[model samples]
Target: MEEADSCRRAALEAVADVEPPRLHEYLDSILDRASMVPAVLTLESAAAMRTEGRVLEDADEPHRDGESEPDRNRTQAVSSDRDPARITTHAAGVQLIYEGLRLTRSLAHDEPWTATDAEASDADLGILAADILVARGFYLLARTDAADKAVRTVQSFGRDQTRREDLESGAETSAGTAVGIDGGDPASTDANLERDVLELAVRTGAVAVGETPSPRLHAVVAEFAADVGTSFPPVADCLTDLHARARELSLEDSTTDRATSATDP
Candidate 1:
């Protein structure tokens, strides 16, 4: 938990320089829980990569010897580098916020899976709130020059969902069967959803910065995304350690720690 807080604070410090001030309040509202592990993890990973060539040295740090500026001046930023990793980190966080809010509204109603229930007056406020979140997500993506990747991600999700619906329309639902265990399998599991969103955000950030990520970076995002999607499952008892492992992976060239990975259902 403490590590997560440190990451959150560090990410906030970096993001504040590029994004609008008021937008941060919205991020705070969305990431107001321990369950937002995905955004936190993604933010930490990208922030580490973003600082690879540069120094953190945010405005809040104390001045060196022979400096004359007052403490008030310390609140200023250091550089205006539009780092790709940092940009995608912010975009991913926005996407997670949108998904979390939308999922909450959709699952809050009596018929949790019913599409119509979430649009009713009872859930109007939540639905509207989710709408704003998605808008904010698009805004951030475009601001970072990841508009194309963001568009592709959304289009992919739509196609996947439509295909799933089409499959279900012609499939049979017998006793004791889940949605994807039967003939409707489209590899749409909970973990994949988390991985897809995480990869999309990370890749979007990387793409915006005109970076061609190595296979290790892609693996890192997938592994971390699984952790976020499963709510830090297998190693939930040792989240601080898990975070440490993830940080080490982000800052160096290292293989994944499969021990912390979530189990398949």
Candidate 2:
């Protein structure tokens, strides 16, 4: 969908200014492998459905009397000004933050380094890209309602990773696929990263529409994300599933609101 395309473009554009062509290319490649589906679509659909019937103009720029038509049109197509594409920036922020965390996890797991100068350079640039992505993501959500959730997600990631390293360092046997979120196993820690990030997506999306996700909604997202079993999908299927469930829950919530409103004096 439109939300995926829009959010991906926004993410790529956000990193367009990274110095050195090779580093920029590396960052682009990382993003290319990312499924810009879950977080962005959740945010877009929530905001769109919640604010139905209202026009949300692209707010990236104030219209100028003398601005060129093409410029205005281009801005509107990618900017988070309206529904379907509403909250593109916020969605992009959640996506980038997740990607950055994912990258950091990879670096921690692999420690990719070599004797060759070029390989070492690439490794260094990878770290740089991760930092830039997280920083940029933070900048986007710095003023949004999801800011604290985003921060907590990152903090949780750090804690999980740290615990995983400590556990691995002392463990006598490989935990394998049997590991779980409570077992202090490496795989489960990794799953927790995805779980927390996905939860952030759901919460961020809901709050973007002025609604807090109910506890049941959080439980649903967490369970789905944790059960992905290690590697995350590089397509929209997983996120699509989440969006469908979230939408259903949101509809239930909306119905309750309407019923309560109708009964109020």
Candidate 3:
């Protein structure tokens, strides 16, 4: 939870330097209106699965035994507290804000809406906030220790969000899963979007931690995402399952384990 708050503050700090206070206020209102607590909790949990308390170095640079990355670039400490991966989770959450603004005609912060004449202007501002957040989210990812993987994960995020937001059921997801965004006729019960976001978090953090995830680890994260996306009972149990499976595979190299209990009862 502390980690979440830290990342939340980091997110605010991301846009705090805007020259115009109005734009900054819009950004602030977006986060201020959204209950980012759950999203932050999931992000911190996934980030915790990564290497902890270790300073990251450029993968391009070689290191001796037991040596951290070369300290030539002493710019910032990406420790768990300021994890960009976790912060990206919140950045991606701007979509939720956009959804609220468009669907509810207000930010839902209980702000005065008497100025119905200002609806278009407010919507424009909200859209701008969402757009800035998307760019910021991708920017944060591109700055990670694993730039390639981080960027790809965010790309997948875009595709997944587009697939879900298309309002058309049975859209073929990039992963080849035909998930129904709406409940009218869900071809696949797997359209749980929470799992997709969390899985991306796990994969991004895994790469950031100097590890290539195994298929079992992927399956574990996917299952947890599925459980949480579908509102399965005891979602925390899903997270526990992910932690145990990830820990088990952590002890083995990428080649040893490929099968998992995903299909098990």
Candidate 4:
């Protein structure tokens, strides 16, 4: 349990420090390190359940509750051997979920737009943060109970749709009504959106950072977005847009890789 807690803390800190393109890399590293605890705990739990089943079957033969004390003791002995690891996994899972929450909060902590209105603000940061939180919640849900709870909490918070207020505020900010506008280009804005979504997807353990929509992934995103009263159409549209952008970026990356390789020779 202590080890798990330590892993969670370390993972959270690492993610907090990660920059845009590198966030997913940090998450992958942390998850790889922490993966062993749950795997071991799952095996131990399965073994205990099997043993408990046999003991229950034997106890049903002829004994009343009080008379099965000896059998109960034996069953407990076996159970005890499994308890520490199970506890450790549960604790670790909880800690990881908490870390996910912390990450989300940190991302949402500020305004989404920069003072210049050209880049992502602290609010936009929160949306990106929430995206990662939702994805991580899905990944961890398969391994831990705490992850399910985290998913529920995030679901309660609503989806990733751009609210009217947000759009209006953003437009105003970019137009220089708030602070002076930074005059960032459409390409930069699009790139930022793509980068943020891809970062979230990778952190959540999607197979690749480029375009490719798994139904399960879409379902997860839909659930998260449902809170904002976003219908499936817009959600689908957003996802398609992200995927298209990711594919374009991937092609660019591939071209760059080939060029670099060619140049090296």
What TM-scores do the predictions have?
0.54, 0.78, 0.53, 0.29
Clashing pairs in 4: 111-121, 111-122, 111-123, 112-121, 112-122, 112-123, 112-124, 113-121, 159-225
Full ranking by lDDT:
2, 1, 3, 4
| Runs off by more than 4 Å, candidate 4 | 1-6, 9-21, 24-86, 116-130, 143-148, 158-265
* Top candidate, metric lDDT: 2
What's model 3's lDDT at 130?
Answer: 60
Question: What is the number of backbone collisions in each predicted candidate, taken in the order shown?
Answer: 0, 2, 1, 9
Models sorted by TM-score, best on top: 2, 1, 3, 4
Please give, for residues 1-265, the per-residue lDDT of candidate 2 as tens digits. Answer: 6667778888888899998898899889988778875556456445524633334455564798888989787556534433344477778888899889888888878777754787667778888999999999888778667799889998998988877886788652444434454675578777877777777777667666555677657767667766676566754666667667766775676677788879999
lDDT of candidates 1 onward, in order: 0.48, 0.72, 0.48, 0.38
Error of 2 at 215 (Å): 2.8
For each candidate in turn, give its C-alpha RMSD to the true structure in angstroms.
11.3, 7.5, 8.9, 20.1
Model 1 clash pairs? Answer: none
Better of 2 and 3 by TM-score: 2
Minimum summed lDDT over a 10-residue window in model 3 is located at: 97-106
Q: What is the lDDT of residue 24 in candidate 4?
A: 55
Over 1-265, each residue of candidate 4 has an lDDT whose tens digit, in order, gives: 4343444454454345446755555465545443332222222222222311133223234545575687676554434433444434333333344334434544443444544554465345545554563454355334432344445544433332222234445774565543212133322222222223322332222211112333433443334333322111222233444344434544554565567778895
lDDT of 3 by residue, 146-213 (tens): 44543454455455445544434443543465443444332232243344445545545554444455
